[model samples]
Target: MWTINDFPAYGSLSGWSTKGYLACPNCNIDASSQSLRSKIGYMGARRYLPENHNWHRSKLFNGEIENRSKPVELSGEQILQQINLGTIDGKNKDTDKARLDLEDMQIRKELHLIRHANGSFQKPPALYTLSPAEQIGFYDFLQSVKYPDGYAANVSNCVTAKGGKLVGLKSHDCHLCSKTLRVTDLEKLQEQIILILCKLEKIFPPAFFDVMVHLAIHLPYEARLGGPVQYRWMYPIERMLSLLKGFVGNKARPEGSIAEAYISKECTSMNQLQNENSPKATDEMWSLANGPNALTNTCLGCICNGVQFHTIDRDNRRKCQNSGLVVKGDHEDQLIKFYGYLCKVWELTYLFGHRVVLFQCEWYNTGSSRTLRVEPHVTTVDIRSRWYKDDSFVFPSQVQHVFNVPDTKLRPNWRVVEKFQHRRIWDVPELDMPEFDEVLQDDENSTIVPTEPIDDVVVLRRDDIVPQIISMEVSQSNKRVQPEGVMDDAFICDDDDELTISGDDEEDEMENDFDTDTDLEF
Candidate 1:
């Protein structure tokens, strides 16, 4: 049960004895220290380093280099220095922090749930209720149980020192098939890991689920765990989910046609998961805990949105910089854009948790269900006995390339036009509907209320074209004014190289006079 807290610095597991040093397993020349990199579960080698330590070793073993000992060891300071040199991994540290923030929010929500298990209160629980050290201890215990390899939650090969001097390095024998994995076999292991994690992400929340599945995969056979059975069930489920969108949209199919195709695909992929590769205890547990539709139900809304409008293929390296759209900006088109972005976050969030909801409204049909989803209206989702507050999502930016809302000029859909019309009529009051304040319970949650009511009132005039401001300089480095069209002499471009000789004599005299004036002043 090693936790991140146990090691003040990044160190090896405590229960394990580092009593003996092993020979450089690859080199058989220099002695390998019993530190983090040389031991089992030390897969963070490529994280901050420019080259994989193993890559260097592989090259050496392949005779790319004669001496392996010449490989440089990156100091802690060097790693930080490299990070400052503009590695995106350094920014990933912030994303991890964001994840931790989300986790903290989840924990707070969980504590609230625990406190209100028998009550109706939705207030945040007090921090003093749980011991700080004890909470830390619980997190550590979870880390050890769920993620024994590292904080990254990556599956790793377990190795033991053969000779007292650390000569031999071999993997622990696979329980399913008494075969040992070398470093060469690690890629296969990583693929299996991706499949398992991706499957679990669809079923369970990423933060908790990844850790749980990792633990289940690694748990030994003698523990009498059902990890294998778990994985077996999920294999089909994952296959079904992967192909769900395709089946639904097939024109040659009926509604149930997709289901059969999904089932057939499931069996095929399942057989491959079990037969092609050996399933680990962690893989099994992950598969079992996440049942079919556990993923399907929670992710149904997100998948529906993704399948409907967004493209799964896009250049993901770019981030959307449309700060104009951040505060749910102007333009109905902007609202649609926001819809896509919100849904993308929801999909990502769903991969992270089960408590996701895609909010929608029946007000003024937009043909697209998500238009209803974006309305500041509530879409009640029943999570067992209790109702959880959920909102609709805008699709992710990566998917925006294809997921553009149908253009209104094509007379899009009457329903969409009607929704926009109703959205614009700001003053009209409706009695049967719940006010944003009442439904959101702004008094308790303190959620920000939009200045204008979203339902009957229109926010902007449809016929009025939004003026795109074009600024022009009033004078050199002074205030600017909006220019309607191209300036007559906007930029002066002279064909002939007319060198100005005006005031040359006076300029020379001025320069001499300035020099003389400076000398006199001195």
Candidate 2:
């Protein structure tokens, strides 16, 4: 459907006006949204989930079980004829407004806002809010992230460049980039998507949802009918249009401008390379071109197989530890993979523009299972120990990129090896792929395949036998001590810094004085 575009463009293409809350094209007139004090929120994500799903029965989401059925699709004309209301009542959901709503409702008093003696109001951070320590850990994790060259956009830019505050990430950017492209199940995928969306509602706030988010409900169906999003998206046509638009110097005559630009760019260019059929240069001609000096360049970093790697010389400056590498080759009798740390990068320039790049590494012994252990689940190696000093260098093509995690702070010598496939590959899951016994032979005795009996899979959040209990104790200091006379709708803060619901003792005293005919001076 050529679907890739901005939110407004998405609505326009679907023949729907996206100005208001009823902007979800897939939901049609049945789209739901709660109008807040300033913005609209979509909190009814649980309605889309299957009724039998565990999330439907959980009270964690807004303290209620969702009984509402899936949204019913209706036409715009039918909706207008059915309701015809200029405005819908807004709901005070989450934050300070939520506390006020609960206060008025005389329920969930434990969640009421805490008023300090200094007249400042502060609500305890919600479950979704990360703790200060956890936030620091999250930032550290992102800061230390590394990816192969062309594997992904610079993730560090989203963290380190944001002045220590975590910000939203455009993972695939606003252009062409696919993170995951493989999908297997054609039947249960739609059902799975609904459950996932329902879970998101329990975690994120209502304001997170918009028309575009609701549009995801319809994607699986579209994909099933039309095909993958990669092929059907607008990139191809958009690129063509962009190229033509770049050529246009005159807006008044776009066709002629595009033609001129195409001719100038494609047919004739001063810097165009010579045709392959042109006569080859002699050795003397090559020497003249070289001018008696060899073209040589040195760099601290190098890119191989779309993965970025840095030499040990540059490792001190970088947060991403990209010096680790694993190379698999023949030993005395068997094939063994050696884990190592890259020490240097050598770029050797040769005659006629030929070049060679070698990675110098400090290898660790993989002669026995003590230095390297490959189990069914995890692969661990001791890269702290060094071996194979004589044959320490490897070509870029011979190495596989790997990141290591220490087994524990105390066991720094033992590292859990995490391997990455070649960049821009399929990344298919084993379970999803069809079984072919003849094509692929299973080796039960392999180090990767453990002979130990597998344990039963455990299901999460399935508390069938015991019911969980939650208790909250509101501090006496934060509690409102005085009686608030005749509570009204107004939650106004006066000059004295009080969130007054109604008139206080000072107002009553002033009224009494006025009734007694006492003269008042300013």
Candidate 3:
């Protein structure tokens, strides 16, 4: 029987009371009479004062030593104009206007500003505007302000604890409901509220103790009946109403328009679900150039051109079917050319369809060893091209790291040799190379290892090499594949060979790499 409409609104109790006092709902402080009035007057008066007036000083007029300043009273019309109380003609001086004028005069006298010799009153200053940082600093200062008996800290802690409980509930932590809404916490909250109200009575007005203030005391009971406050809160419902309001194209018949829009949306959604052939409903199939026997379905040997090759296992160890040779003698001569010597090779299928062979090559560097290190860098190459199998000795000039390597080599005429070296030949002792398969598995797991302290070279996977290409694509596609539901026999199976890599340890290794650059050989 109890509906939300039955309860008083949050701000219904706010505004100036019949006694001519303005109070805050949360602090229950009278803005017109007490410390709040002084603070407001002080801040407001500072805007109109000249820069040399020493605004930071506690008392501008040295009130303790000097005689008490005479209070300057203004007329009803002046008071109304000063407070923006609307235009009231001189002919109508009603009892209400007189009462308001008297109240305004009393507030002005309490503020205590100096009256000029000419008898003209100092105008109330504009509101103080603060930047984001200054606003935060001001809020912190207000929160830190102590109550008479040092109850401010206790009140602040209680409010903060209550807020944390509300946040937990909003995040769907239902288990915390019992602990947060315990009878002890509720009693403590009530006591704190009472103490705060008492302390603030001298400063705040009756309007400050609004319905919300009383609601805090009954929160525990409300939680008992409704569960979490978030579930019962109007914010989510209000947000949904705002969204529904956007669908109202016909203002004359808003309800009808909203209903029709809702129905159309539902119908469209239902059609999308039922229609499997719809482009939006289905995922794009991978477009392969070389039929089903593409590199994605088969091994790297399919495009090897009769050249023997090996696969890099999960542990990064080379598993050789024959001799672990990537290319034979003549075939190696055809693939290797002016770009560099192919030091290491890897076959990878990126995303859905992208399949290519990544060649790690060491380019000929003419510069002094100190100027630059001719490190083996990885780059993608199209397997379908005839240049990959032909004996033309024409290299793909679009190399990844060749442009980065300085061409300070003193001897340019030195012939670049072509040879079939094992994968270990390209492995640097100091560099802990990132696994390609693992990097693709989870982007968050990937760590950037700086090659050296001085050099800004970050050694990541080949897929993570090119900043323009890989950075966006890899991050968007890389998702951790959760294992499917375990079968009855899965529990009995052993996973001893599975490499358990921690993200923290990987980051630590990368950080350590930066410090141990001295041991690294060029």
What lDDT score is found at residue 313 in candidate 3?
28
Candidate topping lDDT: 2
Runs of candidate 3 exceeding 4 Å displacement: 1-187, 202-226, 233-237, 250-256, 268-522
Write the residue-wise lDDT of candidate 3 on 171-255 in tens digits.
1211122102334444444445433433332222222333323334344444444433433455457757977998999999999
Q: What is the C-alpha lDDT of each candidate?
A: 0.25, 0.53, 0.29
- When summed lDDT is taken over every stretch of 10 residues in candidate 2, the lowest stretch is 513-522
For residue 505, give model 2's deviation from the true position in Å.
39
RMSD of every candidate to native, in Å, equals 35.1, 17.4, 30.5
Clashing pairs in 3: 29-204, 30-203, 30-204, 30-205, 366-408, 366-409, 367-408, 367-409
User: Higher-lDDT candidate among 1 and 3?
Assistant: 3
lDDT of 2 by residue, 385-470 (tens): 67789998898888988776555433557877777543332222336554433222222222222223222221212222222121
Off by over 4 Å in 2: 54-58, 71-112, 115-120, 160-164, 171-180, 185-193, 203-205, 208-325, 330-385, 393-522
lDDT (Cα) of model 3: 0.29
